[model samples]
Target: MLHDAMWDDEFPHDPTICYLNHAAVAPWPKRAADAVSAFARENIHQGARDYPRWIQLEHRLRGQLQSLLNAPGKGDIALVKNTSEALSLVAMGLDWTEGDEVLISDQEFPSNRIPWQALEGRGVTVRQVNLDASDPEAALIAAMGPATRLLSISSVQYASGLRMDLERLGRACRERNILFCVDAIQSLGALPFDVQAIDCDFAMADGHKWLLGPEGLGVFYCRREARDRLKLTQFGWHMVEAMGDYDREDWTPASTARRFEPGSPNTLAQHALSASLELLLEVGIQRIQEALQQRTAYLLQSISSIPGARILSPSAPERRAGIVTFTISGCPNAWLFQQLKDGGIVCAERGGGIRWSPHFYTSQQVLDNALAILRNALQHYNRSR
Candidate 1:
């Protein structure tokens, strides 16, 4: 277990604000910030003199991602621009027939939805299953018809904070002979995620959210057996097996997930993400999940205690991740969101309510302060009404 001092040292957020927005862009840990600063200094002074070392750091980042996903090998991982790009790779690369279909939940973020919807041009159908039922996985599985070529869903719904039973869905997909894809942005760093356990053919997530890294860099995991299912959509020197062999007349894509990356690596983001992942690995993901569950439980209980506050996110522990969304009766979401923002409570208006997504390291005092502000605002609004 990491000490309290270590948590405090890693996250030195502004003392004045209560940051409960990890579901959105998160503030980088001090180590990640320091790493980017050092990288910038190196580029300013030495300029590619340490290019080899930078590549080494990138390799380390891949290995860390492999560990994070429990991927079969580092070869199974590709560092992409973000989750949308990764999803697009799969959506466009797959060989879709006129009537082939892609299945997804209605609650998916745009990153997971638009790519498949874009496939309509290719005569591919995109079906959205409502996940508000008592058994979401069962609903999804039952919705997969014979033409369903893939099941692409988020591990946790963004607005509702509803965690899916990935393993069950994977089993269903396997039985139906349909490909499984997961948008893991909501669950990757907030909860324990295993691609192997889920048996997903493809999975993707951005570093800026739960991973505590910057924008413009993310991970794409392609299962070893399913790698060849998606045809190559992009090609470049960096993706060739004989990389740097400029004189070679014939070239083949690298026989790994690197085939998905056809451009120069984001070395700067690599260093920052690597540093952030190092902190997560050191503290351990299971511990982080436990801490986040505690925080979510606290938020759920505290928010429910406030008069007229109605929970929008799933209340059951097994059904939720880091998000706790709620609304106060008779209080407009926009106005409530502004009140919280004005009160130094950093949250989001989502799913007809305000969403509070606290990280594992978020202090109890921060949660208390945010809830207090919320309570006061609701009470004042109720009195006026």
Candidate 2:
């Protein structure tokens, strides 16, 4: 059980600002900031003197990402610049024929939807399924046709905070011989995610969101058996099987998912992201998930008691992640969002509502303060309207 006392030193957020926007770019942990500072100092004084050690840090990051995703091995993990790049690798690498279809939810962020849509130039069709049904997974599975080659969906809906049944979707895709891909940016750090249990062929997520890392680093997981399914779209010395063998005339792409990475490593970002993952690992994702659930439940209950408040996120606990979205009558989403911002409640206007995403370390006082702000703002706007 994590108490607020445990997080006193980790997140020293501004006293005037109640930051609840972890679903967006997150503030780095103090340890991550410290690591970045040390790396900057080392680079300033003795550049490349510890290059070998930096390589070790990259290896450590790979192992950490592999463990977090419950991947079969470290080789299955590739460090990509962001989730968009990883999704493009899959969308472009796969061989598609005319009329071959790809299935995705209508609620996906542009990162998940646009990649497959780009395939339309190759004669592949992108099918968007509505996930507003009681059984969203069943709706997706039922939408698959004979020509449906892949099914890609977000692990959690970004705007609505709807957590999908990845395991069931993966199983359905496997039985149908269709590849399943998950954009896990929203759930990777907020909850416990198991690629093996879900049996997904591919998963990608940026570290900046719930992982509390920098913006440029992300992890891409490709199952061992599925590694060869996507052909190489990029090539460079770093991705060669014999990475440093400059004298070799013949070369092969790496057997591992490293084949997706085709350039120099982001060493600077590695130091920061590794430290963030270390903090998450030390705290344990299961406990973090529990704390996040508690926060969401509290927010939902409080918002429900507020007159004319409409909760846009799922009402059932099992269907939610760390996001709680709501709209107050008489206050347009845009107007209410600005009012909350004015009150120092950090959140976003998404899906026609104000979305509040609180992490595990968020204090109950912060939640109450944010609610009070929202309540007052709603009343003011209601009177004006």
Candidate 3:
């Protein structure tokens, strides 16, 4: 279990600002910033003196991702730019036939939708399942036709914060012999994820959201058996075996998942993310999960108490992770968002409501103050209307 003192040290002492937007770019952990700072100082003082140490750190990050995702092997994980790029690898790599169908949710983030849609030129079809149904899983399963070759979905809906039952979906996909892909950007760090249990073929997530790291670097998990089936679309020296041997003209793509890696690594982002992953590992996933649940419960209790406010997210605990979205009756979402912004409340506008996302380390006082400001803004909006 995580001690309160351990999590409390993460929030820098900002007197007036309330930051509850971990579903977006999280405020980096203290250790992460310190790691970057130390790296900068090392570069300023001595150039490339510790290059070998940096390579070791990158390897460590890969190992951490292996443990975090419970991948079949470390070779299944590829360090990529973001979820979009990883998903594109599968989209373009797959041998698609005309009339082949891909199943996805109507509410999928653009990343999941656009890549499959890009295949329209090849005469591939994209089937969208409605999640508003009582049984979302059943709806998605029913939409799979004989022509359906793959299913891609976000583990959690970005705006509504609705978590899907990945295990159940994975089972259904296996039964149908369809390829399973998950865009886990929203739930990767906020909730516990085990790819082996889910039996997914491909899974990817960006490090920025929920992972508390910099943008432009993400983790992509490809099942070892599935790695050989997909043809490589992008090629570079890094993607080849015996990559450093420029003298050898005879080379082949790596037999491992590293074949997806196109170019040189992002060493800077690696240090920062390495530090962030270290914090999560130290806290442990179960403890971090508990903190998020407690904070979200408290937020729901306080937000529901205010007048003219209605919760837009799922009310049941099983249906949610760490996001709580609400809408005030009299205010436009844009207006309320701007008001909250001006009042130093960091949040987002999504799903026709104001979204508040807090990480495990958010203090109760920040939530209380932000809620109070929101209520005042709502009351003023009511009077003016």
lDDT values, one for every candidate? 0.92, 0.92, 0.88
Q: What is the C-alpha RMSD of each candidate to the true structure, in Å?
A: 1.3, 1.1, 1.5
Supply the global lDDT for candidate 2: 0.92
| Residue 51 CA displacement from its true place in model 1, Å | 0.4
Location of the lowest summed lDDT over 10 successive residues in candidate 1: 1-10
For candidate 3, the 10 contiguous residues with the lowest summed lDDT are 1-10
lDDT, candidate 3, 144-242, per-residue tens: 889999999999898888889999999999999999999999988888999999999999999997889999899999999899888898889888988
lDDT of 2 by residue, 223-325 (tens): 8898898988888988989988999999999998888889999998999999999989988999999899889988999999998889989978779999998
lDDT of 1 at 1: 21
TM accuracy, model 3: 0.97
| Between candidates 1 and 3, the TM-score winner | 1
Kindly report which residue pairs in candidate 2 clash with one another: none
Model 3 stretches astray by more than 4 angstroms: 1-3
For candidate 1, write residues 140-163 as lDDT tens digits: 999999999999999999998999
